[model samples]
Target: MNAYRAKPLRYPWPPVLYAAAMLAAVSLGRLAPISVAQSQGLIPWLAGGALIVVAVSLDIWAMKTLIERQTAVLPHRCSSHLVTCGPFRYTRNPTYLGYTIMMVGFGLIMLNPWFFILASASVALTTAFAIRNEELHLLSRFGFEFERYCRATSRWI
Candidate 1:
C-alpha cells in the first residue's frame, strides 16, 4: 500500500506541527542546555537574521513556483502540476526545508543546544508526518514523472 493511503493523522498541518516541535525544543533547552551559541554577542543576532532571510527567500521561491504552476500548496489538496522549476529543481521540498532552516535560526537566536537537538527531531518528524505522504501523493498522481523528479532532486538541501 502507498504511504498516503496508509496514513492516519493529517491534522495540525506541517507548519503548525513544525512550530510546536520548535517550541518544545526551546522549552527543553531552557532547562539545561550543554552550551549556548552566544550568551551576548552581535554575531549571533546577525547570523540568526541571515539564516532567517535565507529561509524566507527559499520559501518565497517555492511558493512562486507553485503559483506559476497553478498547483495546490497545501498538503491535503492535490496539485494540478508537478512543479520542477525554481527551488523545486534542487529540492523536492524547499518549503519544508525553509521552515527547518528558520527553526535552526530560531535555535541560534535562543543560543540553546537543546533546540538544535529538537530541530533534528523535528526534521525527522516532518519527514514522516509531511514529506512521506506528500511524496506518496505526488507519486500516485504523476507516476513515473514524479519518480524521475525525485531521483533528480534531493529531499532537502
Candidate 2:
C-alpha cells in the first residue's frame, strides 16, 4: 500500500447523517422525560450556540497554526508543511477535534442526545480518514520529523 488511500467522496453526507441522528435523539429525549422548552426557553440554546462558535473558532485557530502556513493545496500540488506546535502539541488533529466539538455542542444545544452521538461518530470516522491521509503526507514530506511528532502527540485530546 502507498501508506495512504485515495481521497474519499467529499459529500457532506457524514455530517448530515450526524445532524439527523442528533435531532432524533434530542426529540426522543424531550418527548420521553422533559422537553427543553419547558425547562428553559432560550437559555440552553444560547449557551449551546456559543459553545459551537467557540469550537469552530478553535478549529480555525488550529488551521491557521498548522496547515495554513505549511501547505498550498489550492493552486496546484498538495504541498503542506508539517505543523507541530500550539494546538498540535496536545492533539494531532485539533482542527478535526474542533469540528467534532462544534457539532457536538450544537447537538447539546438542541438537547438532542442523538446529534451528540452522531457528532461523535463523525469525529471518529473523520479522524480515521484524516489521520491516514495526513500521516502519509507527513511521512512523505517531513519524513522522520513528522513521525517523531506523531509519536509525541496524541491523535485526539
lDDT of 2 by residue, 20-103 (tens): 655666676667644344436777688778888877787677767745567532211344566677687888777666667776
Which candidate has the top score in lDDT? 1
After superposition, the stretches of candidate 2 with alpha carbons farther than 4 Å from their true spots are 1-43, 72-77
Q: Kindly list the per-residue Cα lDDT of model 1 for residues 32-85, writing each as its tens digit.
A: 657643456677777888999999999999888898889887667766788999
Clashes of 2: 5
Instruction: Give TM-scores for every candidate, taking all chains together and pairing residue i with residue i.
Output: 0.87, 0.68
- In model 2, residue pairs whose N, Cα or C atoms come closer than 3 Å (at least 3 residues apart or on different chains), thus clashing, are 22-114, 22-115, 26-112, 70-81, 71-80
The TM-score between candidate 1 and the true structure equals 0.87
Query: What pairs collide in candidate 1?
Result: none
Task: Provide the lowest-lDDT 10-residue window in model 2.
Answer: 3-12
**CA error at residue 123 for candidate 1, angstroms:** 1.0
The RMSD of every model to the true structure, in order and in angstroms, is: 2.7, 4.6
